[model samples]
Target chain A: MSGEGDIKLLGMVVSPFVVRVRMALHMKGVSYEYIEQDLFNKSEILLRSNPVNKKVPVLIHGGKPISESLVIVQYADEVWSGKGASILPADPHERAVARFWAAYVDDKLFPAYIGIMKAATEEARAEKAKEALVGLASLEEAFTQSSKGKPFFAGDSVGYLDLAVGCNLFWLEAIRKMFGVTFFDVGKTPLLAAWAERFAGTEMAREVVPDADSAVVFAKKLQARFGSNTSAK
Target chain B: MSGEGDIKLLGMVVSPFVVRVRMALHMKGVSYEYIEQDLFNKSEILLRSNPVNKKVPVLIHGGKPISESLVIVQYADEVWSGKGASILPADPHERAVARFWAAYVDDKLFPAYIGIMKAATEEARAEKAKEALVGLASLEEAFTQSSKGKPFFAGDSVGYLDLAVGCNLFWLEAIRKMFGVTFFDVGKTPLLAAWAERFAGTEMAREVVPDADSAVVFAKKLQARFGSNTSAK
Candidate 1:
């Protein structure tokens, strides 16, 4: 499977989640065909492969489709272990802790940020934005706890947990612009802010992440039509 | 650490998540203390132990506090490997796949369920209810694909991933009532619906689950103040 070209990823360039799958694959040095899908108008291949979710960041191996970004990242980590990048902790407990926070970021924080973007009044939006900062503050502490004295979320190298949490960094910036707030300030959240910067600068993440300008454009469009972004509605 | 009085879980009986920890403990036949806390007016011990998240379901073993349900479930599985119920697979790839969907249920699906419970409009609420079903349908297929001929989610015995995903079954009925919908029809989502019934009937789950009457009382309070649950706002 390592030498074969049977792996393919269905995703769009702008989705931070899709970028997460791409970054993990790149870090593992696993070659794969990247198929960009128009989410508004789905492709037959994408729909058939991922019939249940009908969403991007689906990894197809020989034909089996795996949806969910974190799932895709885990699949990549397990499939290419010890080849290029070992993206998961060897110790099971440490691995569980890493996974806990990754789920935390996706489960609790992102939706709060989405709420902030949808807030109607300036005062309401500001309050919502402040609340989001509090959530980020908790994440900062969690990162400090998980990373301890290491460079990445899991340990010495970027791993499953790091990739799972790292994808949300782009969304953090997007919400900051959307609500005129800056929650990821280094002074306030040094550990997590540094982690985000490090992840974005990584060769794998750099190759996959949408450029800052494009991200800003995406965020503004989402903000302008915040009410309609099914995610929040 | 496995000796008597060595492992203690600090939490109340009211929280489903804390019950998740308790269920895992019972499944593994691990002995532990059940400490109660007033979440609205949290105890100092709870705050210090889980300073990062300030949440319940904290597991203390050999003088260390491990917060988060999934992490604690994994810890329980690791410590009580062969006592009774063995959660989590030995094979790395199967373990990875299990962990992936467990994360999916907690991260993506549960939030959508929460949204449906909190929605202000009937249409918006119905839409979120559908989203929750979409998520459940994905889980249904994952169960079908992985379970194959088995009766459980991760095969013979209830695994960590099963505990992780199964923990939410009790809440589905209550949450569905809040949105005036039943997204998980036993007839429609046969695999998942049957899985939920099987998981719910377990002795551990049966003992901890709040009765239908209590669930109605709890959910009604949430409905009364649906717009004020500021966790997402």
Candidate 2:
């Protein structure tokens, strides 16, 4: 129920968690002030907003800050329920299913992604990619069940599970572009591979998700900052 | 809205997560069939119910399985909203806060608690306890803000954040009785220390939470099974 310009989102360009919130805003047509944070330098408001974890994707609504990516997305869905189709499924069972996959993305898949970036060599990167794909392969049935023969996890519309996985795909795309490490390998996770291409092509994803090339540069810088071992081999 | 027999909770008495679901059911005035699972030899129902995780604390409602403690608890709240006080707050911001703390319990607090159990040496156990207290100290502010001059996080009643942390307290109590490792140190986190006592004394907690003595025995057995190094000290 927030008026236009009343909402402000604190985020970084490279963070998939940030992208998830931006996508939710776009889907709901809730226009807000997007404050880009210099994560390396940190920001006063960002820290103040999310004092607990001190991370980004903090949505300032009516002067109250909501942090954590999943919580913020759910908050947006609840507060702006009338504005757009619900972000989470209306049915409790369906909602639980969406949440299960979302947690899976955060817990297993994201760490594997971080593993690729922080891995010292190409082989290590490949190993991380393989790990991520196994996680994705596990979700193939989830995608099938949630989609119900439709194109999205919400069945004809992008919903929580879609956004959860979709936001991370941009990073995967950038990794593939730079390191040739494929996450949505067509031969392995065919459905997710197709879904990735389709989701990335969407207007909301195109605008909200960080550009693959830009993310590639950022990824390189990120790896370099960690150590030269990342550049080794 | 589920009838007495319609809800089936798959769980173990020793699991804090399972205890959470039981607490929710009692609060909501809902009755369910409790199926105690053999964690070592998982039942066929448990396997079929939660194919993804195949873990305990799976709530089967109307033949649909909902896995994950947080998810199951939230699902229970949503599905039985009219029965009792809401598990999550009515306000979106409040809900977000509760979710954030629940997640914190899962991510940080639980792991630290586990560290104490898995630690081989008494010194290592103390170190883990110190780390856990640091995490608890951070939550003192959260309790103050969420409680807002009320006794509970949901203001005058047990709610999401309360159950999230409260369920874990029994384990801590067991650890305290056996290992003398205190999580809610009165000098360190006075509010949490007091809250833990108050929470455990409640009727819902007493009935649902596993007995501390039994948990202590379980803990000893668990540590012993891990290795003899656990007993060396």
TM-score of each: 0.78, 0.95
Expressed as tens digits, the lDDT of each residue in B134-163 for candidate 2 is: 789888989989999788878888899999
Give the TM-score comparing model 1 with the true structure, all chains together: 0.78
Give the alpha carbon lDDT tens digit for every residue of A21-42 in model 1: 8888888888888888986689
Fraction of native Cα contacts kept in each candidate? 0.47, 0.91
- Please, what are the lDDT tens digits per residue for candidate 2 over residues A102-171? 9999999999987887877778888888888788888888988899988888888899999999998878
Tell me the spans in candidate 2 whose CA falls farther than 4 Å from its real position: A1-5, A121-123, B1-5, B121-123, B228-233
Model 1 DockQ reads 0.37
C-alpha lDDT of candidate 1 relative to the true structure: 0.74
| Model 2 lDDT on a 0 to 1 scale | 0.85
Best by lDDT: 2
Model 1 misplaced stretches (Cα beyond 4 Å) = A112-121, A170-180, A193-195, A220-233, B79-84, B90-142, B168-233
Candidate 2: residue A216 lDDT (0-100): 74
For residues B1-233, write the lDDT of model 1, one tens digit per residue: 34645676888655667877888888787777778887568888798888767899898876678888878888778766767777777665577668778777776788887777666666777788788888888888888877876878788667766777777766677665544467668877888777777877877778766664555566565545654331221
